[model samples]
Target chain A: MNPIAQYPFEISVEKVLKSSMVADPLTLLDCSPLTDGAAAIILAREDIAKKYTDTPVYLTGSGQASDTLALHDRSSLTGVLAAKIASEKAYKMAGVTAKDIPVAEVHDCFSIAELMAIEDIGFVSKGEGGKFVQDGQTKIGGKVAVNTSGGLKACGHPVGATGIKQAAEIVIQLRGDAGKRQVDGAEIGLTHNVGGSGATCVVNIFRR
Target chain B: MHKTSVPGVWRRFKNRYQIVGTQCETCKTNFYPPRELCPKCRRGGKISEKKFAGLGKIVTYTRVHAAPAGYEKQVPYAVAIVQLEEGPMLTTQIVDYNTDELKIGQSVRATFRKMYEDGDEGIIHYGTKFTPIRES
Candidate 1:
C-alpha cells in the first residue's frame, strides 16, 4: 500500500540525503531535522472552556521519563524504556487504554524511530511498528491516525518547540479543526515527544 | 557549547583525553561527559574517577552526511549510544560496515580514535567510539 495515500491530508516524505550518519537502517531524511518553530495550546476547565468556545479539549494526563543516552548502554533495542514509563503514567492518569486513542502524534526523529515509537506508545505490539505503518494502519481512517502533522520527518524538529506542537496538533484533532488532516470523529488523542535518542520521552493525553 | 565554556578549561585539558563528572554517594549516580552535581537528588555530588566501560550494543543509530566544521571530514559517519553492560550510555561513532547493516540490538564495543587535531595549536582530540562486534 502507498503509505502516503493512507493519510486524510497531503503529507510527503522529505528526505535530506546529508547529515550525520548516526545509525544503520536510518538516514538523514528519516530523522528529524534540527529546526526552529513554536507550538502553543489553550486549555481551561472543561465547563469554563465550553462556555467560551463550546469546543474545549480535555488535558487528561501527562507523563515524562528519562533513560541513559548511550544507545548501546541499553539492554534491549526493541523499544525505548523511557517511552514505556511515560506512556504507562499517562494512560493511568487519563483512565483510558491505549486502544481508546483513535489518533496520535508521535516524535519521529528518524523513520526507524517512528516505527519504534508507535509500539512504545501502545498503538501496536512490539516489533510490529514497521509492519503496522507499512500496512497503513496508522493512516487517518485506518486503525489510528499517526503523525498527520507530517511528523518531524516532513514537518521539522524544533527541539524546544516540538512538545507544544504535539499538544497543539492534538487540540486541532479534538476540535475538528484539522481541515485536510482531520481524523474523522477523533475523541481521544495522544502525543509523544523524545529528546536525544529516546533518552527522554513525554506522553500526553487529550480528550474532546 | 562555546558560549557556555570557561575560558581556560579547554586549554587546561587541551592535550589530554579525560571525562570529568560528579558522583552522588547517596544515589550512586555517575554523570559522564560531566555535570555540576547529582541531579537525581538535591544533595551535592563528589568528584571521582568516571572511566566508562567501552562495550555495548547498537540499540539504535543514524548517519550524518552534514556536520559541524570540525567534523566535516567525518561526514557520513555513524553516531550512536553504546549501552555499556555495567550501566550508563555513551554517545560516540559506530564504524566498520555498510549503513544498511546497522541494526537495533546489535552488539558493539568502544574504542579510541583520533578525531582531527587542531590546525594551529595542534591539539589532538581523542574520544571514545564504537566498533561492531563481528559475528563468528
Candidate 2:
C-alpha cells in the first residue's frame, strides 16, 4: 500500500519538498500532518475491569516528566531527556525493562522523533537509533515492532489527542484486536508521548 | 491578529533585543532565557545578569514548511538550534542567507529583527535571529 494514501488528510508534498534543507534533507514526507481529531478511553478499577470486559488489558505502569519549555534550554539536542527519565521510571514500576517490550507505539510527530524515542527508551543504544531502524530491528517480527498502527507519521496527529491515541493503539495491540498489524504473542506493549520539542514526556506500559 | 499586552512585550525586551541571559554565580552555568533561580543550585545559587556575545554555531536545524498561526507568511523558513559561545543554546531563525548554506557546526551571529507585527493597530514584535558569518 502506498503510505501517503493512508493519510486521512491531504499532505502538501510540494511545500515539504521546497522546505528541505540541503544538509538535513527533510521533505514534507518526513513530517506529520496537522490534524484535527480526538480520542478517549474508559478507565476501570481492577475489580470492575472484568465487569467491562473478560480480557481486561491492565495498565501495569505509567511515568511522566517535564523539562524546560523552550528547545534551546535543553542540555542535549539529540534526545529528549524527559522521555529517557519517564521511560526509566515506567520500566521500573512495571518490573520490566526496554528489552522486555515486544511492541511499542511511539511519538513520530517527525521521523527524527521516532528515531530519538527508541534510543531514549533504551530499545537501542544512544546514537544508534537511525542505524537500528535501518537494520530492520524496529520492523514487525524483528527485534521490536514499532508504530504498527502507522504511528503519527502515517496516522494523523491531533495535538491534544496524540497521547490518548498512542495509548489506544497500545491497548488494541495488547488485546490482539489490531488485525493485520498485530504482533504475534505480544504480551507486553509500551506507549510514548512527547509535547513540544522535549519539554514533557509520558510513558505507559500495558500488559495482557 | 494576535494580541500581546505591552507589559508582556516589555518583560522580554531585554532578552529578546540584547540577548541578556543569566549566569549561576555558584555553579557557573549559563542560561539563555534568564532564570530567576538556577536549577543546579536551586535556592542556594546567586544569579547575575550576563550579556551574551551573540555569536555561535549551528548544532541542528529544520526547514519549517508548516508554521504556527502568526508565522504563516514565513513558511519554509529555516530555524536552528545554535550553541552560543557562552555555552547556552538558543532557537532562532536563520536569515540573510540561502538555506543551502546552513550546516551543522557553521558559525552564526545574532542580529535583531522583527519577529512579527500584530494587527495594524498592534505593536510590532522584534527579536534576535542569526546569520552565518562568512569566512575570509
Candidate 3:
C-alpha cells in the first residue's frame, strides 16, 4: 500500500519466512528496522494558526498513560493497557469514539503490534483486530483507515521521531494534504504512540 | 550486552541470583524485581521480601536466531515469558528442553544457570532460567 520505500524496502512473504528469527513467533520481517531519520511538526496558538492559514486543523483532545517498563510487570499481555487507557481518555475528552475517526496513525513497530494497537485504541473489538484487517476494514476505503502513512515498518522507524511522525501524519490526513493516501472526507483523525514496552502511551484526536 | 560493565552486574547480582521480590501485605499482591514502595497502597501497604517457588507456566515464547551482542554465539536460543505461580511473569531464556514440545501453557520451573558470558575471557553471568518441568 505504501509507494515510497525509505530505509526498509519491500520483501515478499516467502522471503520473510526465510529470514532469521529475532524472537520466537517473530522473524526479522516482523520487526521494523532502525533508520537514521527525523521529523518535525508545527504547533501554533489558535490566533497564530489562523494567521498562517484559514483552514487550520484544530487540536481537539489528547490523553496519555503509563504502564510498567517490563513486560513481566504487566498484568495483561493480550493488549497494551497503557494504550487502552490513554485512548479512552482521549476519546472521552474529544467526545468521540473509535467510530467517529476516519483516519488513524498508530505505532506499529512490529507487525503484530499494528493489530494489537488497533484493538487497544478501540478501532475494533478487543479480539477482532485481525478479522477487521482481514476483512479489509483497515484499508483506505474501509471502516477506518489505519496507518495511512505506511506505519513504522514501511516509513522507517526513527525511534524518538515516531511520536511526532504519527501526529504529523494525522495532521496531513485531517488537512487533506496527503496525496494519493488521503482518506476521503476525513473530518476527524487520531494518532496513537507507545513508548518503551507500553510504559508510556499518548493518544491525540484531531479535527478539521 | 557485549561489553557489559562489571560493577553494573554486581550491583544487581543479589536480585538476579534469587527469585526474591516484594509482596504487598495490604493488597496481597506480589511484585517481581522487588519494589520497596507499593504503588497501589502508598502509605498502607507493608512490603515484605518473598521468595517464589520458581514454578510457572509458559505464556508465550520465541526463539532468537539473531542474538543480541553478547549472546551472539548462543544463536537460536529459546526465550519465554513465564507466568510465575506467584502471580508474576518473567522474561527469561529456557534451557534443557525439547524444542518441539515448547508450547504455551506448558509447565516450567525456574533453575539457576549461566545466563551468558560478557565475552570470551569475560565473567560468566549466572542467573535463573526456566526448564520444562520433568513431570508436567
RMSD of each: 6.4, 4.7, 4.0
Candidate 2 chain A: minimum summed lDDT over ten consecutive residues — where?
Answer: A1-10
Off-target runs (Cα >4 Å) in candidate 3 are: A1-11, B1-13
CAPRI grade of model 3? medium
Best by DockQ: 3
lDDT tens per residue, model 3, B1-136: 4897776867565668888898999998898878899899999999998988889999988888887788887788888889889997889998889976588998998888888886778788788998998763
Compute each candidate's TM-score over C-alphas. Answer: 0.71, 0.85, 0.91
Worst 10 residues of 3 chain B by lDDT: B6-15
Residue-level lDDT of model 1, residues B10-119, one tens digit each, is 54652134433445666777665555566656655555556555566765576766676788788778877655664565677787766555776778876667777677
Candidate 2 backbone collisions, by pair? none
Between candidates 2 and 3, the one scoring higher on TM-score is: 3
Report the C-alpha lDDT of model 3 over A9-95, residue by residue, as the tens digit: 557888877777787678887798887778888799999999888878887889999998888678788899999999999999999
Which residue ranges in model 1 land beyond 4 Å of their true spot? A1-23, B1-64, B78-113, B128-136
**Cα shift from native, residue B117, model 1 (Å):** 3.4
